[model samples]
Target: MKMASFSSYYGSLFLLSLFSSFITIALGGTFNTDFDNLFGEERVDIKDDGNSMTLTMDEYSGSGIVSKNEYLYGRFDMKIKLVPGNSAGTVTAYYLSSIGSQHDEIDIEFLGNLTGDPYLLSTNVYADGIGGREVQFYLWFDPTEDYHTYSIDWNPDRIIILVDNIPIRVMLNRQSIGVPFPTKRPMRVYTTLWNGDSWATRWGEVKLDLSNAPFVAGFKNFNANACIAKQGTSCKGFNGGKNKGLDIESKRKLQKILSKWVVYDYCADLRRYAHDGLPYECRKENLLQFE
Candidate 1:
């Protein structure tokens, strides 16, 4: 009886420890307030003691910022409220990017719209300066009405983008098939409010109505649970290899969002890439087939 009881007690303790390990890996990293003005210094406002930031865009200039540290891999989250009414021709972009002519980038750009129209969310990935993997969506909720949590879960295996914690799109690592993934370079978080008037709204059909000038966007709760590039080449934990990939629940949410809200998926557009065969990422079933 004593032996059995001891075994049972130790078994329960072991199970508890295992569960706690997973939870720790899932939690976010530090709240990152390390950012500096990238451009239009006068138009950017930092409040809440640097925890929150707001960008203003007027006829004269727009504003932007960049993180002080660069990260190799991990999850990044920010709560943002997009430009309000009649935001046509304006774009509020939050993304991660590296420098140089052939740079790497992961984008989350809000293409403005007229009042009553949903803002178009454009996402793209660039590896070694070769981009064009564009996947666009129309969010189910009114982004301008309230702040929404946007996140990017990036690692060596995949890149998963989430809105309000729900996965919207995912790009898998397909380097074995000659597809480039943004693993070699480290990127810094960046946000910009600028005039993309020529092609932002309805492919330029709608111009920036300066009458509704002085567009503004709000940002707060910036978090970075990532492996800072400055901290040596190897590190363990979630920012490193601890994050294997999305679990079953996240994959299910990704599928639902892709089917319902996705307005444009480059993978399915035959006309755009008639010259070359479909990108290797699209040809493989593993890209979207979660089950």
Candidate 2:
């Protein structure tokens, strides 16, 4: 397939404008305190007056929040501003996960970095209690500078991760190859700011600097429309409808981003797959076949 030039990708900025408008309508209204809910108070502080909410993490403890309801499959989007400055050893994570020992999960973790270095954006998937499919990337812009939209679009067929409307990663369902896809269980959207000093930065090479304690991450526009799953009942399908998938133009934009910004991809990591070969989708040369 022919790749898209950087100029072509830049020319398509209007699509992002359209996406932002669509999201505003889909989300219903501006973020307010009524939507602000907390899970852990001691570590998680909530100042929901009527607008957006901010979460902070310190040496003493970290904080997190969960959606009030669970979802099966659909699009989840959030505008987040990550922790700024010497945030080495900290992690700002957002993902979906089901309960139990054999639960399924999709992760988007921002691994903190030292000043002047880029944060490592890590993505992973877990199925039936097994997980190791890890991919990492460096974003095109400074995430801590401003809030950017990050989205996860999940369906039975595939999973797509988007940053500012540009596709960064795509994970196809490989159930045909005896691989497990997240279909049966319903998951709740969760976000957390934590101290992962042991392994968050360069595999622990950079330790957390407590002097920059109480790191803060801001969140807003938590807009998600999907099928709600209730306990003791079968999950309802996405009756509300699925989000738009990548079109040829969008794929072109993604190609440009990946070529210039992506630092690591599990599909191309020979060291990780040396012992057992690449995953089914990777070997099959699916959408994530950049390398």
Candidate 3:
């Protein structure tokens, strides 16, 4: 019995060390309590000593907020609880964007669903103002019931989108292969609750139900462990330092989600891009990396 106890104690220590290794390699971030109102001030509310905020969308207008600083690359996180019930036409979006005719962007848009339907999470990346890369998925959990962490890890090498720290989608940097990657510009984090009725639900088949008006979404715990553009190119304390690709465990989880929950991938739609052929990064080897 004594030997068994000793074994168990050492095993616990081993596990703790393993976890600490992961944490130590990444940069730490603090929760942001404030943001600049992008629009519809009356429809936005900040509470809990700026620790939390909510955005509302009514017939008159919707609301948005933008981070105070622009970041070039890093891990950005937001905990959000989506609008509830019959929210078919609304879209709650959290993304990063730079301004200009030729800009770069990374998006995480939640397309609202009917009372019992699942929400659709759509992700896309735009480089140099041209964007057609889109991949959509259905989450494993009911997003409206509670806050869930949605995160984006962007670096020079790749872009990873995660739900509760599990990567659901990843777009690797293929600039070498002639694929446009968002690398040069700096982006400000933005979150908004707005109506996208014309194409948000069933390709616009389902319009907004204003009867359930004043649709709202909750947000809190914003963290940006990034290289602020005003600072320098080197992100000294950014999480996912040095643009590491997925570790073995992360790759496994990504493969599982892609196989089970992915609803749409622009790369696989032959009809849409038959003339263009598949995108440069859509080759078999790239997809096999996670598998």
Candidate 4:
């Protein structure tokens, strides 16, 4: 009887410890402020309140790449619900950069009016603004119909983009010169709605396209690592303009590689394509630059 009692006590303690270990493993167990849900810099509510004014389309101060002050990398996880609207516009959950070089922009755009079939998810990094491509995806169903966790783990060697804890896309952030140029920069977490007339919605009898000017959106859980490497600068420089420092031949080669995308149209397509892909193309384009 004594032996049985001792065994039971020890078993219980062991079980508790095991469970705690699992929890810690799940959370990465480090004291991370990026996961904080507190108000202010941590929890930025998108809705208009009595005190705080609503955010605008301009580069957001903290959320969007308001100039060069905001850039980042690391694991970005967002818990958000899409707002019900005309179902034709785009709501920016976050936008890192718009007009820049080196496929630097990272965007989380929500296309509401896509045939009401699936929600389009774009985790894209366009190079030189017009010359980059975006890896596109279509969710299992209407993400706006429910709340889902969207995330991207940007490591020095690669990037893993996940939707609802399911790894959807992965990219190898490697360069050909025997160097790895991981995406390390200040990124903005934007949540706004936009028009998607050229894209979104394929089978609707009455198409609800976003031909209008603006749209609305909401976001929860916006975070980044803001890691910047010294060598990464030269590689991500203004390799966009013609006759730039990056050999003209190299620039032409880039244009040919970038030709797969129809500029804005294809960028939207990648954003609206099924979840089976997205970051793969962006990563490919990014990788191509290095090659």
For every model shown, the clashing-pair count is 0, 0, 0, 30
lDDT of 4 by residue, 55-112 (tens): 2221222222232223344455666666454554344444545334644555666655
lDDT of each candidate versus the true structure: 0.84, 0.77, 0.85, 0.44
| lDDT value, candidate 2, whole model | 0.77
Query: By TM-score, how accurate is candidate 2?
Result: 0.81
lDDT of 3 by residue, 142-256 (tens): 9999999999988777788999999998887778777889887878889999999999999999999999998999998887777666532444334445547788898889889
Candidate 3 weakest lDDT stretch, 10 residues: 22-31
Strongest candidate by TM-score: 1
Q: Indicate the residue-level lDDT of 126 in model 3.
A: 97
Regions of candidate 4 where Cα sits further than 4 Å from its true position: 1-69, 91-93, 98-103, 127-132, 177-185, 200-216, 225-291
Over the stretch 49-168, how does candidate 2's per-residue lDDT look in tens digits? 423567788767788877766778778888889999998999999999998999999999999999989999999999898787887889989999999999888887778888987888
Error of 2 at 147 (Å): 0.7
Better of 2 and 3 by lDDT: 3
C-alpha lDDT of candidate 1 relative to the true structure? 0.84
Clashing residue pairs in candidate 1, if any? none
Q: All candidates' TM-scores?
A: 0.86, 0.81, 0.85, 0.48
